[model samples]
Target: MSEKQEPSIWQGFKAFLMRGNVVDLAVAVVIGAAFTNIVNAVVKGIINPLVGAVGTQNLDHYSSCLSSSCEGDQGIQLMWGSVLGATLSFVITAAVVYFLMVLPMAKYLARLEARRKDQEKGTEATPEVIEVTELEVLKEIRNALVAQRGSGHDER
Candidate 1:
């Protein structure tokens, strides 16, 4: 048999776009963007200062460009302190979710499943069925014929 033809670029692109995974990813992206502002605010509000006390530095005011020309080909320099603050906030959020949501949810689901299994296991098992063999049936038929002959049942 001949190999199937490949889908065209447009067809493939459409298929990719139409898949549920892609749609879910798109929705997650939108939600993430909306949530980012709140997360950033919390970091800026609380975590940065806490870190600042330990390092004797602040995350709020962290970047300064060193290029002599203010606008030549230089992009915005990276601010490590702000990055650190963001990272710290992310860690905190991750920890909270793990402890408060994911861990507890997992444990609860596991316990529920275990309980269901236990209930099922406690019930009695079904009885085994026996299958008769052709030889056994033939033996019984022969015995019945012998007994009928002994009882004088020769109607034929």
Candidate 2:
């Protein structure tokens, strides 16, 4: 009669918030936002002109109409290059994080978790109980044969 019930919606939400991964994700997101600012500056100040010289950089600023009424209008566009640069920066940052941080961390954590689970299961084969390596067994046999020959000559 005292069985535990499934968690309520709010309780589930609280549990989600308390999870280690959720907290880690929040931190990573904050750092990533800050990182984006740095990357944007690097691209705009350093990389953009280099890339622009290669003709791969988007130089197309803005679409404009040349109608008589619009002759005096200038489509001011420092924003587009910054926007494009920011997009490239974001992609590069995301790739670096995925490869360097998230993927390797996930793999290492999984390996450690698997080892913990194996230890908990207590089904791991005992190293002492297992047959010795082939090299060790061969070395022991060789030593025994050598001893036999040496003893045979001594007995004679």
Candidate 3:
């Protein structure tokens, strides 16, 4: 018997590139990069100004000195404001992506799946039909067994 040949590296690479998920991932990456710019703009132009109403206009500048001499970067500085700003940006991005993109997509996919199942149900045999068919088959089998027993008794 002939042994099965392994796929070549080039063939495997070509298959990987041709897969639908690879294309989807590439599209997602491009869209994500574009979406990041929009989120960043919103955080800078809108959120920063709203926050600035109570504090500094820029979040990056807000920090605290941990040591006695913080002058000219001489002491340890805790840049908690930048961290807070980053957290805000992350929260905003996640909310927008979830509410606007992911939630809608999930709902649309669910509807499509439901419609597909309904269509399949219409095309395929129903459970009642299958049960009836099974009952008829069982009756035919019983009748055949009874006739066989009658013939056997006559032969004896």
Candidate 4:
């Protein structure tokens, strides 16, 4: 008997690399990293300036003293502006990614799924159903019994 040969490590690695999902994920990761730079620039240039209208341009500088007096490093400080800026950036990035990529892709996939379902439904054959009355059923049973007797199977 011939034995089946298992695939080598290189063959498995090649298959993994050649997969569509892996390639797509790599492209997405690269694009996402580039997009992050643009988002960071926008936050730093435009959004930070807008935030500056309320306080300092650098949000890290906008801190409040927790103690009675803010003497050197003696008092505790709450950096609310930095937190606010970070939150704004996160919201902006999420909104842009959703509107530009995720939302549209989801909508397109939904449309494709709906079309596939419609095609499947259209191609399928409807089953034929015959409604047999109780009288017909009884007649069929009688005929079957007669046929069985005609078969000449005598069990003496």
Candidate 5:
């Protein structure tokens, strides 16, 4: 009798890391993180200045004091500008990802799927003539003999 050897923890971990999904997810996370900086910069350097053309230079400066004694001291401030800036950043990031990455990738995958289906259809369209095996012919003969015997019509 032979004993089965179980895989080690390190081997299991390596297998998990080598999986396509895991590697893809890791790459996505890294790229997303890197892309965030560019989005933030665009929002800060371009959009903020564009929006600032009408008023303050920086969005962070656009805050409303909530407390009554808000003058000359640090009071409760509603930072609506920062919120707007963050929202703009998020929107820009989403738009870039959708238009640049997601849309192109989806189109490519669709083309691949269509091509694969077309190839499958092309192959299926060409009908092949099926040849019966010897075993099938033998089976039919055996069935006929059995039926003839049951009906008491056997010829010696």
Candidate 6:
């Protein structure tokens, strides 16, 4: 009696790591980290300066005290400016990724899918092709049966 053995843990791990999605995810994470630097630079260099025209250039410094007669580090300070700066950075990053990467890739994939469909349609068998194939199959079956019967008669 033979027993079937399950795959080892190492083999399963290797297979998981070798999947296309895992590699793609790793690449995306690396690229995203690199892209984040560019987005942060844009926000600090351009957006902060523009905002500085109205107030201070440093968003971290902008805050509001919620309590009256509050001394150093003794009040409810709402750092809305920093939140705004972070939000702007996120929005810029999203826009850049969508327009530059995601949108173009989607369009390219759509074009490829369309082309594939067109090729499939072009290669599809017509009624005449089907008829000819059926006829050939029938002829082969008839010849096979005839040969089988002739061999049986000889054996007898």
Candidate closest to the true structure, highest TM-score: 3
> Model 4 over residues 1-156: C-alpha lDDT tens digits?
999999999999999997655855786799889988877776667766776797666556777899998878788889887997677768866776666665665555445545655688886333333344446554655565557655755753
lDDT of each residue in 1-156, candidate 2, tens digit only: 799999999999999997655855686799889977766676666666776787666634544454434434554323465576567767765665566655665555445545655799986533332233446444654566668767987998
lDDT values of the candidates? 0.63, 0.62, 0.69, 0.68, 0.66, 0.67
TM-score of 1: 0.42
Model 6: worst 10 consecutive residues (lDDT sum)? 125-134
Instruction: Report the C-alpha lDDT of model 1 over 30-132, residue by residue, as the tens digit.
Output: 9789876766666566656666687844465666666554354575665677987677667877765466655665555445545555679995433333343
- Winner of 3 and 5 under TM-score: 3
Over 4 Å off, model 1 = 1-3, 59-156
User: What is residue 122's positional error in candidate 4, in angstroms?
Assistant: 4.5
TM-score quality measure for candidate 2: 0.39
Model 5 over residues 1-156: C-alpha lDDT tens digits?
A: 998999999999999997655855686799889987876676677766766787665566677888876666667888898987677667866776666665665555445545656698884322322344446444655565567655774454
- The 10-residue segment of model 1 with minimum total lDDT is 124-133
Best by lDDT: 3
lDDT for each residue of candidate 6 in 28-109, tens digit (9 for 90 to 100): 7998899878766766677667767987655776788898845788878889889986776678667766666656655554
| Ordering by TM-score | 3, 5, 6, 4, 1, 2
Candidate 4: residue 60 lDDT (0-100)? 62
When superposed on Cα atoms, how far off is each prediction in RMSD? 23.4, 20.7, 19.7, 22.1, 20.9, 18.1
User: How high a TM-score does candidate 6 get?
Assistant: 0.50
Candidate 2: where is the Cα deviation over 4 Å? 1-4, 59-156
lDDT of 5: 0.66
Q: What is the lDDT of residue 8 in candidate 6?
A: 98
Model 6 bad stretches (over 4 Å): 1-24, 37-58, 123-156
Per-model TM values vs. the true structure: 0.42, 0.39, 0.53, 0.44, 0.50, 0.50
Candidate 6 yields a Cα-based lDDT of 0.67
